[model samples]
Target: MTATTTAANPDAPATAPRYEISVGGMTCAACAARVERRLNKLDGVSASVNYATERAQVSCGPDVDPRLLVEQVQRAGYQARRVDDVAGADGDDDSEQARRVTDLRRRLAVAAVLAVPLCDLSLALSLFPELRFPGWQWVCLVLAAPVVGWCALPFHRVALAGARHGRSSMDTLVSGGVLASSAWSLWVMVAGGTPAPGLGQGLSVVNGGGHALYLEVAAGVTTFVLAGRYFEARAKRSAGAAMRALLTLGAKDVEVVRADGTRRVPVTELLVGDVFLARPGEKIATDAVVVEGRSALDVSTLTGEPVPREVGVGDQAVGGAVNVGGWLRLRATRVGADTQLARMARLVRDAQQGKAAAQRLADRVAAVFVPAVLALAALTAAGWLLAGQPAGLALTATVAVLVVACPCALGLATPTAVLVGTGRGASLGVFIKGPAALEATRAVDTVVLDKTGTLTEGRMRLVDVRPASGQASAELLAMAGAVEAASEHPIAAAITAEAGAVPAVTEFEALPGLGARGLVDGRAVVVGREPLLAELGMAVPDELRAGRGELERAGATVVLVGWDGHARGLLAVADTVRTTSAAAVAALRGLGLHPMLVTGDNAGTAAAVAAEVGIDDVVAETLPADKVDVVRRLQRDGHRVAVVGDGVNDAAALAAADLGMAIGAGTDAAIEAADIVLAREDLLVVPDAVELARRTHRTIRGNLWWAFGYNVAALPLAMTGLLSPLVAGAAMSLSSVFVVSHSLRLRAFRPNR
Candidate 1:
């Protein structure tokens, strides 16, 4: 995400400048909402804070100082820094995340070691009276102190910070439970004398009538909660692995072509317009056009295609693509942030920052969830006291209520699923814009496909070659190819490609409206339309004319190849359909999407292409400007449409549709206007993109329901004294782990063939 802030001009109107602020010290969804509220309170400032990303996207009036925004977040008791200034490099966020994971692991290990002995001793004394040796409670106290104080310090510190700012969070509830349990146990040890043992006693908190000790509750709860957090942090880090892999694909060093031979330099130092050489098995330094040599590039890392693309001089090569054949000398057209690889990384990061609508509702609920649980705990304690229950039992029920109700699960429900889903999609060659686009995919019932460049190859190529009777096919093709090579038309190129290594031509003559004429192997060859053949006093045979008509009816462009005063052969060429287009259309039907073709080609040609691709509905002969009208007409008829195209003419229609998917090999304008970009040329990825979105959205819904349902059901059990505080802590932690683990399932999502 990029943000800009400039000096305010008094005479001009105030423009809202955007900024990204990296926020720290947020422990739950409520913390993010609090920071958002505080930032939004300023005049003419609007902010949205994402807890998953730990960044706030803020838009404020030009007159507002960005530093003032930082001060407001700090006042709310959190660390704040300008993202553009601090995280100017890529690896900074990864390093910070790694540091957090290590710290959590250390804390969890300490808590687990101390809690085990403390809980064992307390449980033994309560269950068996013979195990209650002299000063056994002192042994329990000694073991529990460090577990409650040092091991749980992170929770206490965050809770104290919130208290200072007059706020409450998930950590506040945890701290309250730990402190209450540990303080009550200390009092029992000091004032109540040696506690007598009881039969049928449960583990954790020990109670013998008037005197009840809860050192085990304090220690056990702290350890279990820490373990949950440790695992949760590791899961979150794994969710971003795809993006990290993408960053690693670039070349570290480049061979810069200099006046004094070629010099080796860091990729960062390579500037635009500099020429670079890439040998076999080397990655392209940046986005560049080939200036010398020829090679076949393996672009699977970028586009997910296994086939290597053959490229000669003047072909564009993207950064991160490996040259697998021969050598290539390239001039950099784009470097640094201007390259496509950088743009892709930015898009992925920006997509992760958006929150779904359900997540927004969950955040609102969590913002007040902590305080509500506190109130409920107070009521539970008072009700139990009034109902003739002992004070010890009532306190135990209240502690359970505080520990059982978890807002952490509610905070994690949506963002984790989105992170894993988007990352997995990027690996499979699908780039979703954000949660909104993923949501849009769920409702799309119709897919509007542009015929050219989408289902078809978009470039003319050889389809067939026919030779006249009593003529050698090779000799006729060689003469025609030599004459047509002098012309630069699409049909001529196709013929030249088919007749590989043809004999050279001399005395080539250009025909503007027709094809060319040249002397090949001491023979005068003329290749063009029938008019060119007739102009050269050449008569076309009846069989070849019938053959040309047959090819044209099938949507192929036919051209006559003739020499020696007669038409010798008919060559057919057309924009052929992709091998995967038929299966892609079938897959769309399986997903219950009605696919149709909308293009600028003639009705006959469009219909033939549609039939080949298994699309029954066709809207042909429409102008490029009229494509948007077709989409609007469909929407008016109650269909949600997704349009896929790959040209500048399709940009408007793509933007006008409900969901827009751009082909990866498409123009820049089309890619920019799209909601989802298919990074591979294969049409099969289109269905994969839709299926992944539907599956991800389903996972998110499941997580939200589980999170909300667990709290609603567990709180009642805790309030009724059926659940102990130690058990409540375990359940609460498990709820968060389950939510994160459920989201991680998206990493295994496979593309539907």
Candidate 2:
């Protein structure tokens, strides 16, 4: 016997451990439950199957043989691989299998067409007596059989296979009940029994015992189960569409330039070191570096920023970005699965595979639920038989228990809510990584914000210019602009913009980190930071320092300009605050979370931005590596933290935090690392995501309670022979309807904030 273990429950002992197993070869819902049942049969195994992606995760005891478990799955005609190293590769086989499963939609459509008429026939016989034709009824039943069987053969096949192995599932319960009902009805018809009066019959046959054929009941149950399955496939397809769309973003081909000549080739065929020529208005086909020429690339597809970024030789260009102007020759640096887009797509795929904590609990309850119901039904029949009840009454009570105690409602609860919530979040420009991330967002207590690009507009602009030594402001600006024009730094743009007009300079020289120098109007001019001016033997006055302090307090980067090697004036430039930052910060605080600011900018600028956004705690002048350290420190202090950032530098911190949120308008590195990606740069979506996750969590819990309550309360009533088969069928259908309708409420969610 193989050892198995259940997932650690929240109320379980603290010493209990949790485990995850990777499942494979699941092609549909039936396959999901099939693997789930086989693994669950082990003493302590508890598992959930995510059909959208073919993976089953199970948790169990420490003594279980991981190898034996894998062999059990393989014996059941599917692969089972342990997730020993969570490489996050989105393994090649899963993607291919996911694509194959998408075709199940065709199967669902066929099932739906067969179900409609079967339901109509069933309803007509029950509601109107005049419509019954004694001879024609058997003909209708025969006709409906093929349609129902053909449409429902998938479930029958899986259920029969499970039964052969002494295992049972939701399919086994449903398939067994419907088959028994259909066979009994056929036997009565063939044996020449008295006909059941149609609806509105004058005779009351209730008190007197009479045999009646119920072909419609058998056909209807099969049709209804098929209908449910069709919709389930459709829902899985809809949710998995995002991963497919992400895969479609890359271009199919690129214009490759080889020694022989330039020719177009498939992107997959392009190898590293292959040079590609991208002309104005052409899309970059793969991740590459500019080897020649210059161009302004519109990376809006990846970053969501509108401004076209200028790139020259040696700059890295990402795939899917459009080259807006100027021709460029790029050497392919990364291709195929190695591209950034591919990596991001892989991340999204992996996230979908890992079930949330709530979902895992639901699976645990469902695992033993069907078998327990089956045992109760058997006991009910034996009890009534021993009490000398008629065989008809005893058998009817047993079948009713089997039919009504189904766990369909329990199975649909969490996945349905998750589907609706994730769809709603995506529409609102919130890209949730997976169900676990969606659930975790509700518990976030600290929101760590990156000062640059997140709280502020990432683009720097000139705010003020002050002249020194009694010189005219414009004169200082003109000299500064002439020298600064030779530099490519962001601060240089502000200086040149303020300098309205200046003569063309000669003898231009750049001082790397310090600044630039050039001869303007036959006079040498220098523009840079204060330290650079002092290094050039220029005097630093107290007035200049005072102006620098004021600007720095306002989150501005101060630059100094000089003429003839003498200090001239100071210029202040800073990235402005976003209009939505304050409202977003306030909303987070309303949710009982303290917002903190973390940035690579200096202390003065970080403090200014934090104050503006109502963030109380600030960590400034922090390097990329230090950001992750800070998040760990906060976590060590027992904070459930979520980090929000928008730069490549923030990737480490984003991956380190409890929940990582990447502002959509940033580098691919940040988006790939973070668990949640805000599709719109608006900060309000952060709080909106949290609220949505919380609502989803509530719906799941409510649905779980409803599902559990129904099975617990109604199963006994059914076993006691108080419920008839007709009543049991109606109750079972209603439970499913209630679960679905409850899950649908998440679609209308609108955050109060």
What TM-score goes with each of the models? 0.84, 0.68
What TM-score quantifies how close candidate 2 is to the native fold? 0.68
Least accurate 10 contiguous residues by lDDT in model 1:
4-13
Error of 1 at 12 (Å): 18
Residue 608's C-alpha lDDT in candidate 2? 82
Q: Write the per-residue lDDT of candidate 1 for residues 297-390, one digit (tens) a residue.
A: 9988777777898889977898999999998999999998778777676667767777788988998898889999999999998998898876
State each model's CA lDDT, in order.
0.83, 0.69
Error of 2 at 107 (Å): 8.6
Predict model 2's lDDT versus the native.
Answer: 0.69
